[model samples]
Target: MKTEPDAFSLEDLRQRGREPWEGIRNYQARNFLRGMRIGDGVFIYHSRVAAPGIVGTAEVVTTAYPDPTQFDPQSKYYDAASSLARPRWDLVDVAYRHTLAKPFPLERLRALPEFADSPLVRKGNRLSIVPITANQWDRVLQPAR
Candidate 1:
């Protein structure tokens, strides 16, 4: 889940094997976690920098739960509005498999006319977790021939 502390390179993501994705505080992210199912594949991507891109693949291993950070009042992610009966944050586990030797750069995806309407490659889109179509995944992963 934590591909990297500073920069999430393909190499870093490749090393995170079956780690639980946690510390998500955003409402949308929490909702995604709440709706997650086992074995759901994630296109582990890099963020928080200029050269962000899809680094590798990870499969969801566990279901959703209240983020421990939310319970701790001292935590920055803590929710004063949330209650014990209803936790505010949720997350899933993502098990790393392998990294693409040559990861399809984010720039490439943005340049494709086919991905003109794609949310992941869209300009100014910053959702950490996103869905990937099988065709899109195949296209992005196509090895040089």
Candidate 2:
């Protein structure tokens, strides 16, 4: 999933070992979080940085649950309309897996034939979480091949 490196980097996840992937406000992104199952793989993407790209990998450690931040009034991600009885946001804990030997730059990702139809490479597609095919996942993990 995509995050600003300053807010939460791959290094932060590596240090923490695992953390709740939270603060998603968009309905589409929220749905993606809900759809995640334990052991699902995730690409740790750093966006809005000097060089935006996928840098690491992670795996879901927990099923989707209510995001506590959405219930807190002080949190930037808080939703006034959300209630504990029926939370509007959900999160899944992701554990650090591995950091890529070399960062897969966005420019290279866009040029890859495997990602030609991916939402991640599509212009104006800003969903933090996007579904990728198994082929695309393998390509990311073994880009040199």
Candidate 3:
């Protein structure tokens, strides 16, 4: 998933071990989170940085559940229309796996023939969570391999 370095970094995730990935406001991205199953692989990407890229891997530790942030009025992600009984937002727990030896920069991935069609590279695609095929995953890690 793409996260701003200022918000959350790979090192932060490693230190925490696992954390609830909340604050997803997009319906499509929320659906992606809902589709996640335990043990699903995830690429932890850093966005809105000088060198945006995938810096590590993580595993889905929990299935989708109501996002507590949506119920808390003090949270920046809180939704006034959401209720505890029928939350409009959902989140999943992701556990740190490993940091890549070298981050695969977005520019480099865009240049690759295999990743040309990737949702991450698609114009105006801002979904924080995007599903990646096994082949695409392997191609992304080829540099580290």
Estimated TM-score per prediction? 0.81, 0.96, 0.95
Off by over 4 Å in 1: 1-16
lDDT of each: 0.69, 0.92, 0.91
If the candidates were sorted by their lDDT against the true structure, best first, what order would they fall in?
2, 3, 1
TM-score of 3: 0.95
lDDT tens per residue, model 1, 1-145: 3244374454554575565565676676677777878987777777665676777777888898777777888977678887779877787777777677866668887886756777777777756666667777677777866
**Model 3 segments beyond 4 Å from truth?**
143-145
Report the lDDT tens digits of candidate 2 across residue range 2-44. 9899999999999999999889888998898888899999999
Which pairs of residues collide in model 1? 18-95
List model 3 lDDT by residue over 96-116, tens digit each.
Answer: 999999898998889978777
